[model samples]
Target: MSPQTKSKQRVRDHGEVFTAEREVKAMCDLVKDECDRIDSRFLEPACGNGNFLAEILTRKLATVKKLYKSNPYDYERYAVLAVTSIYGVEILADNAEECRKRLFALWDKEYTAVCKKSANDETREAVRYILSKNILCGNALTLMCVDENQKDTDKPIVFPEWSLLGTKLKRRDFRLDVMLKANDKPKNGQPSLFDVPEEIRKYLSINPVTKEFMAEPICEYPPVHYRKVQENG
Candidate 1:
């Protein structure tokens, strides 16, 4: 019985029952290895205040801290990847907003501890932006993201896919509907979903980053080390 639900009306209307923390941890533990993987992506279709996503972020951040504690640069890069990997779609606007806030708060607390006084404002802003894009207010059933007014204007839910290339973060946006359609087998002789030609499938297995295979990334953000900023000033 999480207090996030406004009243019995919401529960009855939306069937919104927030999972308790104890249960969230237990369920996530079942996929402990994946949860610990810093780059493993997780999407909660009906995320409510982020009980599960928060726990997943905690686990992933712990691994980030353990592996990259000696190198803040690598730690920050992978930490951002871990945050960006998480995606959520909530029908309720408040729940979607709260989920984003909760995930950001969890990341911020650990990020501050790891970076200390060396934390950069740009990096923080980057995390905020990632969360804003990752956790969206939309109907997962319809696979459409909505505007502030919660009206669907035929716009598909688009999510940015992030890949860390050395010191740079490469991002590509994909429409949810198109992604879902990638699973369908059109015909007997048709190429597989994602439009990957059969001849290229073998090559794609080795390197999936081929531009032809993925939608162009919306933007890329270079690494911004806060400690460096302070030293330069």
Candidate 2:
């Protein structure tokens, strides 16, 4: 690519940026408060440019600094500790890579300043693993298929290529007992489909009635249910 073409190749062409100074500060403040409140892990499903994540790291360092005021040598480990506890997911590979770099940069900045030393190979590897597992390059809207019938649509739906470091989801795991029981009951049951959950009723009442309890488009099978996916994911 020529310099001229590169100049025209813009980041905005890919996706919209959602960062604002006030919003970033508020996110950091929330992380600080939460760290104080429970001292637990955090996750970001769509960490675009690491703005929110960077702020999170900063707040975590500040909180840890105050927590271990007397013994500050551990701040380097604290910075890494904070970052390792954080997870992120980004759709774009380049953006995901960028987010990882920014995260490491922030961690290194704090680590070096506090410890007066550079990150070792071990630390770098840890950061890389964290990026590979947590900052995935996949679509959050992805749905799990129960059978071979379910597949991507004929019309290509471009989604992130990244895979999460978690257990795969399945239909049976959702435990939709009421829905399944309603499905199992014969139409002889007293009331009509209307008595079932709104979702079940809606699925049953599509204009072109489907013979199967669940309908699958010819090309795409095992239709995705967003609510189920989120719960399982």
Candidates' C-alpha lDDT: 0.75, 0.49
Task: Give the per-residue Cα lDDT of candidate 2 at 232.
Answer: 26
TM-score of decoy 2: 0.52
lDDT, candidate 1, at 6: 70
State the number of backbone clashes in model 2: 1
Per-residue lDDT of 1-233 in model 1, one digit per residue for the tens?
A: 45656788779977788887789999999999999999898988888788999999999999999999787777888888889789999888998988898888889898888888767778887888888888988888888877766577577677877676665666657666655545444455344434554432332321144312323333334443422211221
Candidate 2 lDDT by residue in tens digits, 98-200: 8888888877666556555443555555555545545655443442111222232222221211222222212221112232333564464334555566533
lDDT (Cα) of model 1: 0.75
**Per-prediction TM-score to the true structure, in the order listed:** 0.79, 0.52
Report the error of model 1 at residue 23, Å: 1.3
State the displacement of the C-alpha of residue 201, model 2, in Å, after optimal TM-score superposition.
Answer: 24
